[model samples]
Target: MLDFTSIVMTIAPELWLALAGLVGVLLGAVFGDRFNSFSFKFGALSLFGAAALAAIHLSGGESFGGLVRTNTFVNFAKVISFVLAGVALFMSESFLKRHETIRYEYALLTIFASLGMGIILSAADLMTLYMGIETLSLSSYVMAAFHRDSARSSEAGLKYFVLGALASGMLLYGASLVYGFSGTTSFAGIAASDMSNGTLFGMVLMIVGMAFKISAAPMHVWTPDVYEGAPTSVVAFFASAPKMASTVMFANVLFVVFGAAYDQWQLIIAIIAGLSMIIGALGALVQTNIKRLLGYSSIANVGYGLVAVAAGQEAGAAALLTFITIYAVTSLGLFAGVLAMRRRGGMVESISELGGLARTKPVLAVMLSVLIFSIAGLPPFGGFFGKYEVLRAGLDAGLMPLAILVVIASVISLGYYLRLIKIMWFDEPTERFENTDAPVMGTVVLSAVVAGIVFMVFISELGTGGWATYAASGLLR
Candidate 1:
């Protein structure tokens, strides 16, 4: 008989998120139209609470009959994810109140998404991973279209649903092939199987499917369109948390199930990384919309993370975790800067709208510069170190070609980041652009960006420390 206590511990984080989501739904419904202004604040606090609880569990033992494990890495990732979610919620509040209804369903959807990501990290089997992915994806689809009043939002939702379904089908089909080849879906069981005489086709298909989820190039067609059409805050959430969850699960798929087949998967990831880098960097050059640019940027960032995975060593694993950590913070900061833009006296959209922003909003301009520079991989900042570590890991693995491609991609990406900086500081304001008398949520979100940039400065200290090192150890082992 299963001990209920163990089951409770194993699923504690999911349960906490779920409970919080349910409470949010009820409270939001009860408050109805009365608390529209407060909806976002309520949601952010709940997510922050869930993050705290997940951290507490990290210092404890693993649970769920060993099918799910919680440790420092998962905890740290959860905290990062939850923090991003909170910022997403906070940034979206003003937009939601102005453009759409601030409903309870939005908060519920985000909570469920967070729960799904938490489950994915703890999963010990391919089935558990699939369940987690589906849960997260389904909620995300709804969140993408939450602003049903907007044609773009509705279109984004439909596109995401169609593309996401195709990806999920591919993932399931690949999982079946893997089970057929090895007769098991558990990571440990798959690792123990002798695939010596089995066809490599199944493993290749599985890797391709996982690559699709991570938006690694050729499979990234839907990303930019969706990012442009969906709400900016949702795009920000998509850019960071989901990518981390999906990447971690993909890493688990490779390291745990196919550890013995390293040479084959390593080459595959290297190719994907190269393709993603090229597409992400070149694609962003033509983008005029901030969200679309981030879509392409996200593709490149995933490539960066995959560089570490291709290394197939402990240092590579550590680098992967550290890169995602820095990227999440930078991502949050960038979105906050986007939110800070006032359009027609509201939230601005086009790149041109940022002209002379620095003259009027100096603080926001500086914060935006920090985020853009970080994203561009500039030094004396975290992005620089993050890229350096990944390149070093790839070099250690004798992957000089992939390393070279990463550098080229970063060079190509400079155009957009630099354009933003130039417009803010040099150009004169086209017109008086004051929306809200005061930027409330924008300020709060920028505070998060500042925190992310500060954390980057101390990356070396934390990257090699207890939780970060320990988390990397688990993935490699």
Candidate 2:
């Protein structure tokens, strides 16, 4: 049992960030757009602060009378998501300034979104979970339409809001049913209750809602439109932080709260996994827009993560975290590469525009190819190992067909990934890309380096895999 002071201290990072966001709102109101640069840096540092605190205060316990929980698993999620959120803010500062849409509120909203993710990772009860989900959804909807002048931006905002609202409703309905059936809103209590028909139905609904939030297939209709329509910087952020949080949430709700009913939910997850992979694989093939292609790629990657989730047990959780870490870095790099595609002070989005990239920007072309190969699950990169772990986990859990499907999907995805590589290396170069922003370049280089290095430690006997296994044990126990 934790004392009040100790409980508050455990959650200090979130408190610190919330206070920072409040201060940022006041800063923006007083200084207006002139404060944009400082605000971005301010927000980024604040996110890093939260991440550092989480890493430093890494321990296990429940707080707020079991509303919020913190442990190695939750802290690991918090640390990674907060770091990604900070990078997003840093990247946003330059991109927003260039487009003359820079606002202090942008950074503040991001800070708030990061806070929501923290709440989610720490959530020990259904009510806290719902609050965290809504907080993230509301902030993200606004950020998607930050450029209110553009029709595409407005459309993106509207689509996300409408779909997101529906998803939220489903989740709440499920939560209410769960409370009614279990006689409590606490995850621990719900997990301890008998698995009745009403509870199972409610769990399925909650899973559907969560799938929509994560853009897993059948529920993933809005992803491409939102990706293509939103600002590249915003999409870059979306691809990393929110995706990580949602995946972790999916695993948490499944393995921690509903572990006893694994036999019941496992099939549902496996079916969704197959559908997501098929849709993601085929969907990207015809996408002419780079961002849209990436949207589909994200859907496919989620499928890969879910394969691990369906595996169950400690290995499943470890593989899921490992895959997500590599995926997040790969995505940041790919989107940062997108951020580099500009000519004559205007952004470019078409896949064909990448023609002759090797001759024009050799370094970027290579970096992108490396990222593409990584995502395609090619050899020696971190992504390949990430895929390997999940597949192995699936097979070990007697999910032979899902493992086979995983291999087939990887093969199918190579079609588009290789197409991009050929275009960059073989085709005649398109117009020269304008000088890339420093932050954008930094993200690309940093992500690529991490992707390159992660594979080494990821496979080592005492490295990333071990850390993930330990974290998984905490959640499982």
Candidate 3:
């Protein structure tokens, strides 16, 4: 049996988060509106605290009697989860206030979701992974519908739940198949299994299940609708950190658990990745809703991230890590830019609404232009570097055909991104493009813009150091 003390030490950061969440929920229940200001600040601080703990505890490994594992990859995933969770909290504060519900419970749910993500990242066994994912998914469904007054919000939550449940069922069945064949759910056990009867079927089922969760193609039908319907802040939450967790989990299952059967699954993953990219790029082209456009774009991004998994090599793993790190920051920047588009009226949701935005909000227009170019994989931008890493890894794996398809898909993606830029700069303004000022929101928007550019420019040189490398290394294990 593993030492109980060892498991506690290993998962201390998660423990802290759980406790903080519970405390916040209780305090919020008792204090009500009087607690709004305090709860918001405290929740943000607590998430920040979790991040600090994750950073400080990056050294220890192996916990929870072999059921839970800690390593560089999981640790890094934890760090990313905490960091993104912190950002979501900050963004949500303003969002909740605007919606007339700044309850501490909302922040607590997010914190709990972060805790769940950390659990999933560190889970060594399939059971633990399942629990973690469900915890996170359930909390997310609730957050999606938190603004229950809006029918769109309720519909988004319901759709996510139904689809998410189906995905979870597929994953669970796949896990059962593997367990029935190998008599164990541990990654080590799966890797060591000599039996081969259901391994391939199990792998395919498992990949399909994971693909659904990550919103990869063929199973990505629910993504755009849900994203468009959900609150913009919640959409941003779904876009960034969870993808990191799912990507890491996919690598762990495919590379660690099924390493012996790499040849069998690599081709399958490559095909999925390739199809995701093509579908994502093409589907996004016709989308007028900006969030829906981003939804399709995220599918394409996942496609690129999955290429590293398909490679099944250390360099590919490292590249995946770096790619996702850059991806999260850029996505956050993009979402923040979208949120900043509101003028004297409601949010500008349509792509055509951006016509001649450069004429008035020149600063925002410039930032949005940079973000769009970055997403399109233009040079000197983080998205460009991130995509490059994934492509390089695919080439190294000798998946030349798949790499070419990725390039073609990226080229197609340029249509929508460039279209947005053109409308922003060159097209005539609609009657809707009136003047307004939201100082705090504008500052937040500018911050994301500055962050995206800084990371993109420096990732090549500075990405090799500190938590980034440690973060990359964490994924390999």
Candidate 4:
């Protein structure tokens, strides 16, 4: 039995963020719009503090009757999520100010969402999982529509809400079935229970719902619109932190609750992986809007991560974490470049809008190109190394067919990724985009540098232990 003090110590980061969110709510109520800038700073600080606390308390154990878990695996996800979320909030202050009314509620909502994602990373029970996911979903729905003045933003939010609710219902029904068939809501209990047909059906439903959350294809209808309609800064956050948290959760539930049924579930995960890659790779080819293209690109990337997942075992889990971390940083860098594309006319969303960007804004163009190359899985970059690990995992697991699909998808993805680069470098110069301010420039450069160099350092420094590989090993052990 765990004492209250021990539980508190274990969940220090979550407690801190929870308190911070409530305080932000109070401040917003008291000062209203005046609190916007301050809220951004405060939210960023609070997230940073949560990251620190998570780092300090990092270790593995179950508490609250095994309803929550604490470990290097979960902590790794939480810390990265908090830090990336902090970066998003820190950068968004200026972007929000420039485009629309910077509401104090936005900051609080982000804080709340971070709090939810923190729960997601640590969730150990079915009820806990549902709560965390819904919290994150609700906040995301609101944030999608945050630019209330725009019909597209409102539409994005509404579509997200309706679809999100449907997904939630499926998840709930699955959870209920799992509980009814397995006789408990605890993941450990469910795993220990017999694999009845009803239980398997429940697991499938749950996996289907989770696929939607991660924007896997066939269930990824909401992604493109949300990416296109939401504010760029918010899209950046959506692409990075939430995806990281959800993917980690996906791996966690699989490894912990469903490991007993690996033989059965592996095929399901593999099928989803193939669909995501095919749809994402093909869908992006026709897209004219850069954000919509990225939306499909993200779906394809999720497929790549799922390939690692289908491979199973410690190596695959390690590859998944490493893949997602590199992917998140790469995405943040890419979107940072996008955020900088605001011109005198307005924000640039179309692919043609970037014509001759290299000639006009060489530094920004170079950074965006580097990120695109990195994501395209080209050589000597983080994305390549990340995919290398994933392919290695798939081959090690004898998933040759999936590996072949991965290669084919990589070839297909080059169509759009290279097209973006070509337009930036070779096309005729268009109207000059807005001069990128210091914060945005720093974000672009920092993300690009991380994509270009940081993962190399991580890979070189990694051997037998450290980071994604080690983190995954810790959980598996």
Candidate 5:
């Protein structure tokens, strides 16, 4: 017999977010133009409520016969996704309004995306994982092209949809192969089945599918184009929340279901990691567009997280979680700063446009510099510790060569990051960026910056706080 209470509790966060999305859509339909102001508040509140509910269930357990599970690890990732989504939505309103593209549907899609991420983080079976990925991808496709009038926006949507379809097909084919061989789609069932070559092939396909979602290399070709074409506010959410959920999902599949077959997948993941770091680092060096540069930077960051995943131990999982948390916070902060880069003409995308920003908008310049420094893995910033954690995990796992690659990637990444900083501080003034009166964007950026600084100062305490350890142990145990 099924436990009704357990099922309800287990799915409460997803239900709440789904309900919030429905309400947002209904508000848009009912009030028409009057819904814009309320939509931001509604979306933020809904995501916060869902995050709170997930946090309350942190001591999680299996429900729906283990199709879904809630535990500290799952809840932690979900809360981060929800909170980041909410912040993105809240910060996006002014930018969207200024672009004349504000709509309640934006909030609705964001809510739905958060719901999808929540589903992915809590999913305990292959079928459930597929459902979550589809939900997230479908919503993301629409969100990416929210500006229907712009050809670039349309291109982004079409590219994402086509690529996303290919990924989904691959995922489904791999799932079918696993089910055919094991006669089940559950993680436990697959784990207990014989590790045949076909089963291993299926797992590889699944990993490749997921790699596309996380923007890992070889599969990351779509990322720069999409990031460059999409609206910056939407890209902010894209760079942070979805990546978090996908990375956690990838970690879960590898560490939980495929634990016994680590030898088969480890080399593949290592290659992906090394390639992502190299491609992301080297590619970003020549990019003039800020968004494209950050997009490549994101690919590199994903590589760093994957290094931890390839460690295949509890420490690796913990380090992965920690690195992603830092990455999300810093990335959001960077994008928030990007959203603030406006002028009488329109929003700026070129790195040259930021030249001499220090003379006009000293505060924004400083914040951007801090974020860039952190991303470059500079000391006394959260990003440095984030890289250290992953490198430490890689070295501990005896993956010395991988650790060295990470260092090389970091050094290569510094070139572009410092260039951005130099443009802001040392170069001649190109144009005056208009001052943004967007309080929500300011608040989000400030919070992320402060958190990044604090996390750096308390790195040891935060990493050892048992959150990652507990979450990792639950999945790996």
Candidate 6:
């Protein structure tokens, strides 16, 4: 029998976000254009509230008769998702206002998406996972096409919907197979079942489905188009929070439920990781559009994080968390900088448009450069430490080859990152980009840069008290 109180406790954070989304919808219906000014603030409030609720439930337990579980790991991921959603919302306000497409629906969809992420993190059953994925995917599809007037935006939405639906079908088919073979949908039940060929095949299908969600390569065809076509603010949200939730969910399912079959799955994950790294590095070199470049960059970064996950050990789990934290902060900062790049014509996406930015917006140039370098995993920044931890974890797990490949990919990636920096600093000044005053975005970029630079302090402190390790332990338990 499931306890009512336990069920309520398990879903508290999601409930808060859902309620907030409803309120946003109602406000939009009632106030129309008048709601634009309040949408961002409301959205931030809801996300923060949900994040606090999730934090309070860190000492989680199974609920709804084991269909859902909440623990330090789930809570941690949910909090990060909520906070990132809020940051994305804050970053979007200026962009939306500038584009004259400011709608309360954007804020509403973001909150709902965060709610979906919370569900995914807490899910303990295959059905629950699918439900969460659909919720998140549906909201994201709509948000991508929010600018209905733009042909590119509409195309982005259509492509995402079609691809996402296919992925969901694959996931569902895998779930059915798992259920048929193991006679259960619950993680604990699945873990207890004997490993069979059918179960392994099912797991592979499920992984392929999730690979699409995280924009891992081969399944990453939609990412560049969507990133380039979708509104910049929406892409920022898409790249950060959803990726974090999906990646963590992938780790949870593999490490917790499929631990008995580690050898079989490890190779699969490693191959995917290698492919993503190579594709992302080489693909970005020729990209003219900044969003498409970052889309590829995201794919490569996912590969790096997966290296830790493939380790399938406590150190690897800790490293995965650390890497994601750094990635989330830096990605948000990068997109925030991108959002600030408006000119008299409109928002600029071409890399060439950023030439001579140093002359006109020197501060923005420096911030963007720091973020790019950090993404390249250069020393003295959080990205370096993030990569170090993951690579070290891979080495400890005896994955020398994968670690080396990651390093090579990182080197390859530096070419484009540096190219961007050179254009910003050394190229002759062009027509100055319109001096849009996006104070919110500026603050976000500054804060992220500061955080990235100082994150080593947190890592040092981790020696005495291993929060990441503790969180990883919860997942295994």
Q: Lowest-scoring 10 consecutive residues by lDDT in candidate 2?
A: 456-465
lDDT score for residue 455 of model 4: 77
**Cα lDDT tens digits for candidate 3, 79-181:** 7767776776776676567668777777777888888888888788889888998988999999888888889989999999999899889888988998889
lDDT of 1 by residue, 264-366 (tens): 7788889999999989989999988878888899999899889999988565877877788778777866776676666665668788888998888777777
How well is each residue in 1-477 modelled by candidate 4, as lDDT tens digits? 548877886788888999999999899889888898899999999999999998887775667888888788888889989988998888888889887668888888889899889988888899989989998999999999999998999999999999999989998998899999999999889989998999999999999899999999779999999999988888999999999999989988888888889999999999999999999999999999999999999999999999988888565888888888889989988988888887798889999999989988999999898899899999888899888888988999988998999999999999999999989999997787778867878888998888877876667443224577667766755
TM-score against native, each model: 0.93, 0.98, 0.94, 0.98, 0.98, 0.97
Between prediction 2 and prediction 3, which has the larger TM-score? 2
| Over 4 Å off, model 5 | 440-444
Stretches of candidate 2 exceeding 4 Å from the true structure: 461-465
Indicate the TM-score of model 5: 0.98
Q: Write the residue-wise lDDT of candidate 6 on 334-410 in tens digits.
A: 87788888777788788998888989988888888888888889987778888998899899899999999899999
lDDT values of the candidates?
A: 0.78, 0.88, 0.79, 0.89, 0.87, 0.86
Tell me model 5's lDDT, rounded to 2 decimals: 0.87
Better of 3 and 5 by TM-score: 5
Q: How many steric overlaps are in each model, in order?
A: 3, 1, 3, 0, 1, 0
Worst lDDT 10-window in candidate 5:
443-452
lDDT over C-alpha atoms for residue 463 of model 4:
23
Clashing pairs in 2: 356-429
Candidate 5 residue pairs in backbone clash: 60-70
In angstroms, the error of model 5 at 162 is 0.6
